[model samples]
Target: MASVPSLSASIQQRVADALGADPLLRRSDRADFQANGVLGLAKRNKANPREVAAQVVEALPTGDDDGLIAAIEVSGPGFLNITVSDAAITRTLAARAADDRLGVPLKADPGTTVVDYAQPNVAKEMHVGHLRSSVIGDAITKILEFEGEKVIRRHHIGDWGTQFGMLVQYLIEHPHELDHEAGETAAGEESMSRLDRVYKASRKLFDADEDFKTRSRKRVVDLQAGDPETLALWQRFVDESKIYFYSVYDKLDIAIRDEDIVGESGYNDMLIETCTLLEESGVAVRSNGALCVFFDDIKGKDGEPVPLIVQKADGGFGYAATDLSAIRNRTADLHADTLLYVVDARQALHFKMVFEAARRIGWLTDEVTVKHLPFGTVLGKDGKPLKTREGVSTKLEDLLDEAVQRAAVVIRAKNEELSEEVVAARAAEVGIGAIKYADLSTSLGRDYVFDLDRMVSLTGDTSVYLQYAYARIRSILRKAGDAKPAAHPELPLAPAERALGLLLDEFGNTLAGVAETYEPHKLASYLYSVASALATFYEQCPVLKADTPETVENRLFLADLTGRTLRQGMTLLGIRTPEQL
Candidate 1:
């Protein structure tokens, strides 16, 4: 289906035609929309602002049944306060409601985007620090894909490092430590438990036993040198860690394909070539026997230029080399036009240097768009990073489980007659939805408190509130047994009805803004506005109990469209909207 023109766009075009220029129009409390473009248009043409406004209004068609503008008046400073006809709102939304995408248009020119996110180290438990990247990246991916852009997900996991040497060597000596039947995939928790035990035991041995430490260092060389036995042991660690990673992602309600799990190890083969190219191109210089790329703009606290180390003096690769290699693969091999790194705010400098280095080496060209979507920390109520009482990072799985538990309590209190099975099922959706919404609703660079109470509250700006709004609309429709939603263009609308209808028409525009800016919070705010509008509509205009049959149907049409808009918006944010909550 073709994209439906929003009421705002239709009105803007009409006003622009009259003024012969772009109308700087915006939603206003004075009217349905207020045009401020006349002030600028008049100043440029050396005409009285009010006269220009009157001329524009005189040229606009009004008072006709088929006309878009119901009324147009000159307000303060020549502002044109325009009220669109109720029929226009109804007709536009009816068109939107008929389409699956809610009339959102696909991009005319789309390109492939490689999003690098949800990075977790191997054989380690994911913590709250990993939440934003996964949730934000997942939402951005969904939104981009919805916009008809080819999105490629990359989970640049931390599966390669010196620590892996200790892990592999320990596994070699204690082959039975990670004992499971061949081809058996370890459960998430069980895998973490086994890996944690081995890590701790090996650490103790490596720290106290000098010979063990030396042998562990040798194991790293073997692993890097393509020794089959060493590589096999290393693969075990990667495989076991993947099992754990998938389990956690499953609990979070995020899908991560095995093929997308490209970690540091994936770019190992390209590291040497990456460093060689940089060195040969003079983009990197040998500083202190290490191949480094220095940027004059990037300086340390001492005012010395900070250099990005690509390779150490001992010929060992640093993170810069691996990252540069990943850029080369993503651009040269995968042919991506855009690259997004959903990482922590602290890593901003690291990525800045890496990106500049790639550009210097000609791996990242002018045609490619590279962005580091940095996110703030998740904080406690005391304005500090969230941590367990023991001062350890809070585990991701434990936090999600607790959220589900809290959701169950809220769900049971609201609907006590629901079966335990139903409660459990709804609890997962509600709990996970709450976490995701809370993260996405906040600005990317701002920290948010991890409070489940506020998150699950039904009266506030939370997922539960939006979910209940949807469920309430569904309940109303169910009560209308034989009265299906039908658009009545002739029926006059109440203030609340017009408000809801107009907001529903903006759904497509809202999505376009999100896709352009890579910000999910805008979509979240828009959905909240929609839910708020629906709440007012319920208080002012009864859906199933209106005065006339046409009124009831028209109101039902508005409610149904609002429900669909909320559902579609929430889905784009990677959230769920249950029929009952």
Candidate 2:
């Protein structure tokens, strides 16, 4: 199916052709759209603004039956306030409603993007600090794929380093520490519990026993040297950590494939080569026995240049080496044209240096687009990073559980007759949806309070509001039996109807903006606007009851399209729209 041209786009083109310049058209309260480009066009050509506006308006067609512009007037400073015909709004939306994609067009030139996110360390539990990266990355991935871009997901778990050596040595000595019974697979919680136990016990022994500490240090050398026994034990830790990671992702309603779980160890083989390349190319110089890449703009508090250390003075590689290696693999081997990192805001400097280093080494070039999408912290009510009462980081699983519980209360209070099973199912959708919406609706690099009360509220800008809007439309359509939704181009539209119709036509344009900027909040705001418009439409115009049969059908048609638009938009943001809430 062909994509539908929005009324705004059509008007902009017409006005641009008449003025012979780009019409800076934008939605306005004075009219359906207002063109401000005439002011600039007139100034450049040394003509009166009002005269240019009049000439453009005179060239445009206007009529009640045939013209797209129903009326046009000159506002202050030569602004052209244009009102599009009701038929144009209804006609454009009808085309969108007939298509499965809602007339959203695919990108003409899409490229492969490797998105690195959802990083969790092995032998450590996930906390609220890990929430933004996972949620934001998941939403971006879905949005890009919807735009026909080839997206490659990477979950860079921390499964390597000297810490693993201690874990492997402990398991070797105990021999049964990480072992599970026959025919028994360790669940996510159990896996974490077992790994935690081993970690704590080994740490206590390593700190108190000098001999054990010496042995642990030696084991690191063996592990790095690829000793089979040591490597086998290390694999157990990685496997166990994955079990825990998957469990949390499942609860959050995010899907993560096993193959995409590439951690630091995945690039171990390339670390030495990556460092050698940088040193040979003069991109990195040895400073005090450490291979480093320094930038002029990045300086420490003492005004000394801060150099990104690729390899430590002890001949061990650091994160910079692994990251550069990952860049090489993604661009050269995977043929990716774009690289995205959804990480903490604090890591901005680190990535800045890493990207510059890659550019200097010729791994990242002009042909590749690399971006580091930094996000802010999740604060508590006290304007501090969220933590438990014991001052420990709040666990991700526990936070989700609490959200679901709160959602169940809200769902039950709304409808006492709903079965427990139904309530449970809907609560999961609403609760998780609320968390995701709250995170996604806020602009990036801004901290948000983790308040379940405000999140599950029925009145405000939350997922609950949008979910109810969708459910209400579905109810109207169900009662709309024997009366099918049909577009009536000849029927006059009410103010509310015209408003919704115009907003529905902007769905494709909204998505295009999101894909270009990699922002999910824009899509969230669009859905909220649609819901608000639908609310007004319901209040002003009756769907099942109207003066004429065609009026009722026309309103129903608008309602159906609104519901579909809300569903599609929510889905693109990795949110669910339950039919009944």
Candidate 3:
């Protein structure tokens, strides 16, 4: 089956044809869809509202044969409440079940999209703040790819700066500090520990010893000038940091490729050319011997226009220079139609200035669009930033480990029959799924509390709920054993079945909306609604113990489809649904 038109789409098209304009149809609580266009159309034409509504009802294709709608009633002054045929709902879902992609059509004209996300600073521990970018960006990447759009992932990690000078200089002085003699390749934990020790010692010396500080500053120049030894030591920091980065990413179930790890250093060669081009084009001007782009709306506390400093008077580049260069590369080199930056809300102004500068430079044209999907913070239950008792930023590894540990306890208590090995495996899935779901479920622009108890709860709007809902359906389908799920459109649907079927039919449309808006929360909400609908259906209708054999089979078919749809939606959100969980 080709892509099936939504019931609302079919009705809207029919109503649009009759009205000779858009019908402005929307789903209603009282009916499958309500047409509010009649009142506006009537008031505009100076015609009686009831008469126009009645005329639309007359033109409606609610006939018995080849008709999607079952009833079209003229309600109130000029409103039309429409109910689609029960057969149509089941038929559309059956079409969805038969084909893959959940009946969603790949975009006809997909464009190249370059997504900048999952940024982690080198030689530093990844804190809870990095979670949103990686999880949200991964979901967006999957969703866009599913929509047939060409997507390029950019880690945009921070792997260069003056900090490396301190770290590398200290490592060179203490030759054995970075020695991996224990083994040729050090573990991620060992690498991080070594880096942490070296960084602390180096910082102490730099603060106390003026001579060491001077040498460290000179090492920064040597590193930038491609001094072989200095560059070699700098690479070790990056390499060790990547080892830790990869380990943490693996635990989170997110894939981070080496090639995609384009850090701050990647655009170094382009910085000079980028600044010169901006200066020659007058996009940037020298203010006190420093390149800057000033915005009228952006003013400092001194009532002066705050400029985005591209380069400092000290002959050093800033983040804006690298970002502007990235925009040029993503456009002029990658030929991306859409440039998406999934950064934190705190960096909103930085990106705003950078994008505006890019637009002024003609690097981002009318055909090319750039958007910053700035997300809100993740607060603790205390409504403050999530932190350890020591008042330090919580490490990413500890957070993930604790989630899994808590999930294991929940799993064992819920089902004592499971073996330890099974509990351990399911715990990881449930825990990670819970964490990712909690993040994705909240609207992107709002801050949400991180509560482990609520997240792993078997009840409420948690991933565990969805996971169990799917597991229940899977269990029922398995009990049916040899009997396969086969849709019977001829059979009548119960009210509960009708509700679930209608909601299920909206899955493809819901997914399309999520992909278009770059909002994973919407998809999360949609899955929750489907799960809720399934609960109501399970309560009102019996699958294995229906009144008749055909009734049982039909209900079984519905259960199976619900399971598959739930699995697909969760997978898109980067959550895994275990069959046995």
Candidate 4:
């Protein structure tokens, strides 16, 4: 593999030689790059288009720059419409094949990023909504890590607040609810189901009975005061929730570290001090006897200004208080240069106010970047927010389980030779990949359908398609046996090979954009393009049955590179591409 010049660099050199000075280069449908600035250069120099273009062409490097510039023509209105050769495309792809990192460079100035995601409230059921946050956040984490940036994951689970009080009070009344000998319960199912039942019963009683509500309220105060018994009960609720959350994450094939989970309760101590910092700075003022920050742009239907309440009139800290404190800790204490909140789109207003308040007090300055990656809802087939047939929000675990089961059916039908264990493992990958890919393939701000059939289908823009493409490439390589993949520089290029090479060279450039935009969907789109191009190439070019050994080796090399690129790209998107899938 020979060294390959970057597309942008190559274009810039051609333009400079042809038109002189800085020339704007962009991808176009008409040509590789339409140098519209050529006319401007002629205007400035008071010369004709042909003469200006001739000088620039003469200045273009000769010997080594042969195939890179196929033709540089002076088009309508003095536009320098340029077209590149297949040789240039192949050389660039060869360069990418030489690098382990796929020719992608790390950011020049990477910073520590603290991301808040996967926040399901403690002692409650996690719905499909939580899936969006976890899936999106996980993809972002992978992409950031690929760019060689430091990423700190914070689950920000809702493990504290008045709800814990109700749960604790109920547990105190019935101490045997969450109590069961280790072996008495089923490995994973029975334990979680029992906890779920107790939680529902406690919630019903707490809501209907006035006396029970009062006791629950007092339990909150006791729990906050570090009452030993109440604290122990609180711990049980958290432990049970973790078991359930872990099961869901496992089914999704995503790893969530135990130590990284820091819920709202974790920021309890800093809440008061955070409020004090805001008040002292005059960033927060007392509104209706409650500490709040009002924004001129945020208004209700009645046209009254909306305020983000830091502290309620009853002296209780709400969600805002905890998040503001978290910002302070992440920036001042953790030394994070980038703060990312991957939450539901519904909480956009809360984050907007929190970020504004954080900036006002200097907790977040111009030097620190804060972003709220707000994602839209997951709708059912009816285009409404996803819910069970009975109208209740579906549990995250149940949804994932069903998706995996559906995937198993597809896998069994397609590949009968796969062992039971492989089928099971592949089912989890395909199911979870379907869900995560569905969320990531689209822009983060839009609603997407949750359809298992569509996700597991072998065709279309699904993970199954990409995985299958990868598996096919691997199979081809295996069939090639000991015949090594050696690039044949002398071989002529086919149309499909040229297209694949051009797309392959863009891997690094696309990743650079993804890192800058914080958009994994862009990377997803790029991977889909690579797979699509490979499919076309496979149909056009013969690998094992080629006319010559050299052509066979070159085609095999191309297939090997495509497989590696697909596998690596899918891994970065948090999707597994099984070699035999």
Q: Estimate each model's TM-score.
A: 0.98, 0.98, 0.98, 0.94
Q: Predict model 2's lDDT versus the native.
A: 0.93
lDDT of 2 by residue, 20-46 (tens): 999899999999999999999999999
Runs with alpha carbons beyond 4 Å of true place in candidate 4: 1-5, 13-21, 40-51, 62-67, 184-188
lDDT per residue (tens digit) for residues 1-581 in model 1: 99889999999999999999888999999999999999888899999999999999889889684468899999988999999997788788888888988898999899999999999999888999999999999999999999999999999999888888899989989999988768875689889999999999999999999999999999999989989999888999888888999999999999999999999999999898888899999999999999999998999899999999999999899999999999999999899999999999999999999999888878888999999999999998888999999999999999999999999999999999999999999999999999999999999999999999999989889999999999999999999988889998887888988888888888888888998889999999999999999999999887788888888888888889899999988998989999987
Model 1 residue 573 distance off true place after TM-score fit, in angstroms: 1.1
The C-alpha local distance difference test score for the whole of candidate 4 amounts to: 0.83
3 against 4, candidate with superior TM-score: 3
- Cα deviation of 514, candidate 2, in Å: 1.0
Residue pairs clashing in model 4 are 17-56, 18-56
| lDDT (Cα atoms) of all candidates against the true structure | 0.92, 0.93, 0.90, 0.83
Local lDDT at 187 for model 2: 87
How large an RMSD does model 3 have? 1.3
Q: Roughly what TM-score does model 3 have, to 2 decimal places?
A: 0.98
Question: Count of backbone clashes for each model?
Answer: 0, 0, 0, 2
Model 4: how far residue 536 lies from native, Å: 0.8
For candidate 3, give the lDDT of residue 517. 91
Model 1 earns a TM-score of 0.98
Clashing pairs in 1: none
- Ranked by lDDT, the better of candidates 1 and 4 is 1
Model 3 per-residue lDDT tens digits across residues 1-581 = 47877777778888899988788899899988998998888989999999999998887778485548888899899888988888888888888888887687888899999999999998898999999999999999999998899999999999889988888899889988866765456567887888788889999999999999999999999988889999899998899888889989888989999988888999999999999999999999999999999999999899999999999999899999999999988999999999999999999999999999998989989999789999988899999989999999889888899999999999999889999999989998999999999999988888889899999999999999999999999999889866777788888889999999988888878978988899999999999999999999999998888897778888988998899999999999999899987
